[model samples]
Target: MKDTVVEVKSLDQEWARLILEAKKIGLTKEEIRAFLVSTKEL
Candidate 1:
């Protein structure tokens, strides 16, 4: 819903293997997708 949200701290991405930097880290493909799930207000 419009009220759904993704906290900045919970989201991290690493594209080093596919692009710029050589150092590798951060969330995997599946982990990154967790941010897209629907959520209800607490």
Candidate 2:
């Protein structure tokens, strides 16, 4: 899939912060992928 950047409003910073916190606690890439797959709003 061709990946591209799209402009979004303020929420990106919050997402980045959450991801950084998750990394500090050792959330695996696979786990994150599974969570996103199971999450409808994602």
Candidate 3:
């Protein structure tokens, strides 16, 4: 999981953008969240 204190100042906007992009790419919320988590680990 990502550190909670990393600061999500633009998280809402970021998430909104991600959701829109995901929709275009046919990605579901679960897939998006998993991808985020996996990327964070890297």
Candidate 4:
């Protein structure tokens, strides 16, 4: 397999802040991901 390099940029500051706030209120990353996925249908 060929080697591949991927570079990821940091999350937007607003998103980072929201994530921190969510964590402060006890939301897990998995739960956040699930909530985001569920919103796709709307």
| Minimal lDDT window, size 10, model 2 | 6-15
Better of 1 and 4 by lDDT: 4
- lDDT of each residue in 1-42, candidate 2, tens digit only: 999776675567776777777778999978766766777675
Please give the clash total of every predicted structure, in order.
0, 0, 0, 0
Q: Candidate 4 lDDT, tens digit per residue, 1-42?
A: 998765444445666777789889999999988876886789
Model 2, residue 20: C-alpha shift (Å): 0.7
How many residue pairs of model 1 clash at the backbone?
Answer: 0
- In order, candidate lDDTs are 0.42, 0.74, 0.82, 0.77
List TM-scores for all candidates, in order: 0.25, 0.54, 0.49, 0.54
Superposition error at 3 for model 4 (Å):
39
For candidate 4, give the lDDT of residue 33: 82
Query: Once superposed on the true structure, which residue ranges of model 3 sit more than 4 Å away at CA?
Result: 1-16
Of candidates 3 and 1, the better by lDDT = 3
Off by over 4 Å in 2: 1-7
Candidate 3: count the clashes: 0
Extract clashing residue pairs from model 3.
none
Rank candidates, lDDT, best first: 3, 4, 2, 1
TM-score of predicted model 3? 0.49
Give residue 13's lDDT in candidate 1 (0 to 100). Answer: 43
